[model samples]
Target: MKLTLQILTLTSILLPLSYPIEFNYPSVFNFGDSNSDTGELIAGMGDHLDPPYGMIYFKTPSGRFCDGRLLVDLLMDAMDLPFLNAYLDSLGLPNFRKGCNFAAAASKILPATASDLSPFSFGIQVSQFLRFKVRALDLLAKGRKYEKYLPLQDYFEKGLYMFDIGQNDLAGAFYSKTLDQVLASIPKILEEFETGLKRLYDQGARNFWVHNTGPLGCLAQNVAKFGTDPLKLDELGCVSAHNQAARFFNLQLHALCKKLQSSFAGSNVTYVDIFSIKSNLIANYSRYGFEQPITACCGVGGPPLNYDSRIACGQTKVLDGSSVTATACNDSTEYVNWDGIHYTEAANQYVSSQILTGKYSDPPFADKMPFLLPIKF
Candidate 1:
């Protein structure tokens, strides 16, 4: 009995809350790196040097790696929703059910980077969420209502969960390093991600929107630091190597999702092509009032986003033989790289708009897609 319970506990920690749908409003559950961080890092762990980071806008440091809101927060705002608190934070059991975001800065889908942060893994975050559900159940079972929160059983068939990670696992692993060592580990990493997805589906999650990766090589921090031709492109606005990898990942993700949808029979799964949309944004920043996509608004003096990957969530800069700030751009909205690795709030908004409006597919965005993904539904 003890051993069985332990195994279940370990599995619980490694899996996510795949709940059955039961509500109208989407519970904005997020999982990724700094791009969607929100105030979680401000809750601790990030070190953006304060003031100047969010100075131009927010007026106070919000854990975002920019002057204002992150993509997740902005999406919530666009949807007319509240900023999701972490599942483990101050808002007790009663308030958690509405929606909870479990993303942590520097967190990745790969387990190898797990050791870096107390060896934390992406699976652990999901497990923690399951435990939260258990807590809610316990609270209910004890005849103690947690502010009368609604249960999945009560809501039934209308909920949503957006999964955004994979980028950290790929980019972080090969930022300073090359994709040389990543080849062997890539499959395993992807397998782990697949496991997490299956776990979520098993838990009753009906509608899911899974976003794939973007062009990591083109991020301004990389081109500025590594010196890639910024404006040079083969009509697609993507460098040869970066787009190749991104395309491959997208293809695989698409296939995996297709298999899952067919295999699951009645599941409503949506695979969002964030890669193509992001590539379009970078390739056509000029269309959106930006002039550059190959440099970050804030980063240390060199490529791949400065700072040796040791520090995140702070002001970064570069100086040539003298002390001068190197991490910032004249205006963040004009550039695609926000602090080197993530996109700016504007970029995020644009992409979300693409996802919502209709600019993400082959031509008309969704016309080329095989399945009819209902964005409004």
Candidate 2:
């Protein structure tokens, strides 16, 4: 009875009120890489369709990289909106009235080649959004029959334009470029980002929520691959050079947000400091009820960081004449890393909780989410 009452109380308090003070973004148009991808990669490329990927929430692989809901999913729920369907997915003739997701696994700010994991670069995503908007308007122009299936013309302007990319850009650069070379590429990357944002603004996108890249060095993949040299690792066992690159990239991104805010009037551009939130979570994992901060829950190998690039989660291979399957941890809630590259659902939930507090956002939401204060997982 006590547990039931607690659950009820939490749910009631967490429910978003229809108050006049909150931001009412009717829909959301999201862009980025795997961190926010709903199912564009799997929907377009037919990959990662396996068990243990979406076991916790959807009871099956739902095209998301995480085991369950992502930060984007939680944010949409908070705003009383349905999850965005991948723009490339057309299996059920999915509804696009709320919005659409253009993010894909391995996507980046710059363009991607055929050899890349995802061909939907930031520019390509913007192009898709443009095509989507045109097609949606055409559908509505036909008559009222299409109103339930697609967004209205004005929904494009009223909706929130969210970005959660750039991680892959910096992370991928480290594979071939030196630390200084990687840092030098930051300007060009942000230049491409700025170009994309401007293109969206030209198309009537006003409200923007941009998330800066997080600590890349702390990811199990990077740590396992780059932390071979003790001298290269930081006090937290993360790769120092990778983290340094991320910090520099974030600094540039924040400045770009500030610039965009000034360049475009009547625009509400909010720069979210996701790097600080993630770094703090990893640094204080125990306080947040997490056990393995830098280790991947669904991966091969074991110990400090259970990750092996050779085998991904839910994949099986014969090694030394024996089958080896990289499986998920018994309890995913205890770990922060999901599959070396992404965050677990629990960690994503915690990040979402912190984001709701309005503390991590620049020009903060004026403490609009006070109801989140008493809630705890």
Best-fitting candidate, scored by lDDT:
2
For 281-363, candidate 1 gives per-residue lDDT tens digits of 77777866675566566656454344233334353334345544434555666666676677766676567656654355322
User: lDDT (0-100) at residue 238 of candidate 2?
Assistant: 89
**Window of ten residues with lowest summed lDDT in model 2:** 1-10
Checking candidate 2 for backbone clashes, the offending pairs are none
TM-score of each: 0.75, 0.95
Most TM-score-accurate candidate: 2
Q: Could you give candidate 2's per-residue lDDT for residues 158-217 as a string of tens digits? A: 888999999999999899899999999999999999999999999999989999999999
> What's the lDDT for candidate 2?
0.87
The segments of candidate 2 whose C-alpha lies over 4 angstroms from its true place after superposition are: 1-20, 367-371, 375-377
Model 1's alpha-carbon lDDT is 0.58
Instruction: Name the lDDT value of residue 216 in candidate 1.
Output: 66
